[model samples]
Target: MNPELKLVAARQGGVFSRAQAMAVGYTPEQIRERLTGGRWERIRHGQYAERADLSALDAWEQHIVRHRRAVHAAMNSMRPGSAVVSHHSALVLQGIPVWQVDLAEVQLTRTSGRGEVKAGVRHHQGRLSPADTTRVDGLTTTTIARAVVESAARTSFEAAVVSADAALRRPEVSAEDFRRLLAVTECWPGSPAIRSVLAFAVPLAESAGESRLRVLMRNEGLPPPVLQAAFNDAAGFVGRVDFYFPDHNTVVEFDGLKKYADGSREALIREKLREDRLRALGLEVVRVTWADLLQPARTATHIRQAFDRARRTRLAG
Candidate 1:
């Protein structure tokens, strides 16, 4: 790998923007020819990554590179307000799965000018400061902490918390850094998201899906569920539930497509058998998918209804 490619790999597989290319000694024509010859891939406008190992360009890697390049290009061409990447761009840089998107947009602070800056790119105006910002791949971005807050702000309360917890659990980010980042957001617009994230994003950092469901439940004012609660029976360890409420005997399972994309029938069958065994243990299990995450209100309602039914069964027994 060349020095540039090495740098990109260090950045978790980033792509180069046109401005980045110019800074690194590649002209627009050279970039174009690289794309034409399949030497480089155009992930988004003015963004290019090497096709040296196309297989390595998984969806997450490709999306992060494209977003990074887009943010860099936008910042280079921006006026009035300096663009500091936020939301999905920040999550991508932090290697979190908050918003899965291919396009990248430069999120500007409130001081940005009113006119439209670019096509196919989004500009988010918010309160920001120098302390909560960093430079990556030649683009300004909200620090990992700020990005976690922004990601949570865009999500239901619990989802945000889970993402924040995950961000903090990463060795690159520390609890102290998260607090410092939160302190700076005191004057930031949408501080509710920041505060809520700070309060709930903790405590369940080890459980991926629990906090997301908890946030949704909290948004609906439902009682918080237990995390990693296990059930035992004569048939050995039944299974582990992502979120469980002992009183209601209800469970929530978060599923990511990557888990099953391997296409193993035996694995799939084993998973199903586990679910069946859990159901047989008199647990009312609810499956939460990515789509349900997008519709949190309905998901919360569904879970609440399941709890009601489980309560009735428990009372009868």
Candidate 2:
């Protein structure tokens, strides 16, 4: 809490190099005491993060706090231009969402093959143009578009779709941006995985759950559904459903965590009425939740049944 140390921490995103602590008039014993008392947490060899700084963050934010500290620590220890953060670490710096990626290692990239700067470091050797790299969080990182594709290439198809969907939904990253970045990486190794994800990624997927649902449908060979489809009655706009099949008059809704985690009674009542309106319009509605997504086969069966029912109703009418 010293004035100089506070200023130093502010300059470094609530992290301070050990030398900064010393130069700011803190003795070695003082630093040891702070660490012993949990006032400061060591973020790798030469960096420290204040306990107070991370107290308000959730689990993921806390991990990011540490991740950034690791980035800076490595940057400070290495020779200039030795490595630039990329892949998952770069995605984190660019504020892009990554699905099912290991966060334990600090990710860095060098155009020339080189050994790591520290322990727990993941090093990638790839050609990076200025268009593909940008500075974020005071460190060199891959641009959002590049990071999304690169990280996606290193993950499973489902995870890749989730990350790509998130990138597509970002206001700063347009469909064109994705295309440009994909074009830049077309000749790179392991790009086919990401190319496949980009081919199917939809911006209408507003959450990880919705992205997962879309991937789930695709993997099962189900007919693609129209996203954010609206249902209206004689009164007015009734509701905008998540996914709709015009071919079968079926509506598929993805019930995300927010639908239940923080859902109020008013929201629940409105949701029920919305469903009623859709059903009244003779559309077969199938709601897919996280649980249903986990049981992909079961969810597919439910959707298939809904499509069949809608077809039968259409024939009868």
Residues 87-169, candidate 1: write the lDDT tens digits: 76776655665533334455544345553545755566666667677776555677777788766555665556656777766
The whole-model lDDT of each prediction reads 0.68, 0.81
What are the models' TM-scores? Answer: 0.68, 0.91
Worst 10 residues of 2 by lDDT: 110-119
**Which candidate has the highest TM-score of all?**
2
RMSD of each: 5.2, 2.3
Candidate 2 TM-score, true structure as reference: 0.91
Candidate 2: lDDT over CA atoms? 0.81
* Model 2 per-residue lDDT tens digits across residues 1-317: 89888887776667787888899788999999999999898877878878756687778788876777777776665566777888778877766666677778887888666645458887777778887888776677787778778787778889878777888777877888778877777887777987898898888888888899999998888998899987789989998888998998999988865755575888888888889989999999988888898899889999999999999999999
